[model samples]
Target: MTALPHHLDADIWLLHMFSSQAAREGGVIRRKVRDVDRIVGRDAFVTEMRRRGYRVYENAGQFVIFCNREAVRRVV
Candidate 1:
C-alpha cells in the first residue's frame, strides 16, 4: 500500500550490497527479509545470490549471506 523510499532497482541494490568492502573481504552480511522482499522479491533475492555463488541462510526473518564461494562443510 506504500511506496519504497529508494528508487534503485532490485538488481542494482543487490550488486551494490555485494560489492561493499565487507563483502569484498568475504565478511558475512545480514539483511532483513521484509526489506529484501519489499525491494527485491524473495525469489529474485535467492536467484541473485545463487547466481553470484553466495550461500544464504534465513533465520528469524533475516538472511545471512556468506560472501565467499568457498566450500561449506558441516562439522558436527
Candidate 2:
C-alpha cells in the first residue's frame, strides 16, 4: 500500500500514495477516483500536498493530480 498524506481520509490517502509510487516506478497514474465527493471538502489535504512541493491541479474531467518538479530534479 502507498503512504497516505497526513490530511487525507484513509481511502484517498491510500490511493494517492499508491498512485504516487506507481508513477515513480515508471507506471502511469491514470485511475479514476470514484469518491470525488469525499475529497473536495478536505482542503487540508490540498495544503499538505503543496507543502510537500507538489503542483496539484484538476483535469478537464475534474481529476486531481500532483507532481513536484524540484523533487524530480533532485532525484535525477
Candidate 3:
C-alpha cells in the first residue's frame, strides 16, 4: 500500500470505520463530517478512495460509499 499523506489520517480512519461496518452489514455507508474542511479536502480524499477501489460521493458535509457494490472492491 502506498503511504498516505499525514494530513489524511482522519480521512483514512473514517474509511476504516465504514469498511468495518460494511463487512458486517453490506450496503451503502454514510458518515457525517462535523466540519468537512477540518478533514482532508475533497480532491485528496477522492483520490485515495479511487486508488482503494471505492466510489465516494459527498453531499451536505457527508461522505457516502457503496463500496461493496463497486466493480473493484479490494482495498490493497
Candidate 4:
C-alpha cells in the first residue's frame, strides 16, 4: 500500500462515535458511537474489524473505532 493518508478520508463511511472522555493517548482503541444512525457523521472508511465482520468496539451505548491491527494486516 502507499504511504498512510495525510488526512482522514472524506469518502466511504464507518461506525465511529466515541465520546471525548474515551479518547486516549498513544496507541489506538476502538470506541462506540451513539448518533451514527445518519451518514454524513461517520468519519469515512469503516473500522477494519467492522469491515471484516469482527466485534467492533463500543462504549457509552454507541459504536466507536480505535484501529484494528490484525484485520488490517490480513486485508493487504
Off by over 4 Å in 1: 74-76
lDDT for each residue of candidate 1 in 6-35, tens digit (9 for 90 to 100)? 656786788788889889999889999997
Which lDDT tens digits does candidate 4 get at residues 5-76?
433232333323232333322234443353343433454334434564444455677664443333433345
Best-to-worst lDDT order: 1, 3, 2, 4
lDDT values, one for every candidate: 0.86, 0.50, 0.62, 0.40
Worst 10 residues of 1 by lDDT: 2-11
Model 4 alpha-carbon drift over 4 Å, by segment = 1-26, 29-32, 40-48, 52-55, 70-76
Against the true structure, candidate 1 has what lDDT? 0.86
Give per-model TM-scores. Answer: 0.80, 0.42, 0.50, 0.29
What are the per-residue Cα lDDT tens digits for candidate 3 across 3-23?
Answer: 556745766665666558564
Lowest-sum lDDT 10-residue window in model 2: 65-74
Question: Candidate 3, overall lDDT?
Answer: 0.62
Rank by TM-score (best first): 1, 3, 2, 4
Q: What is the C-alpha local distance difference test score of candidate 4?
A: 0.40
Candidate 2 wrong stretches, greater than 4 Å: 1-19, 23-40, 71-76
- Greater TM-score among 2 and 4 belongs to 2
Candidate whose lDDT is highest: 1
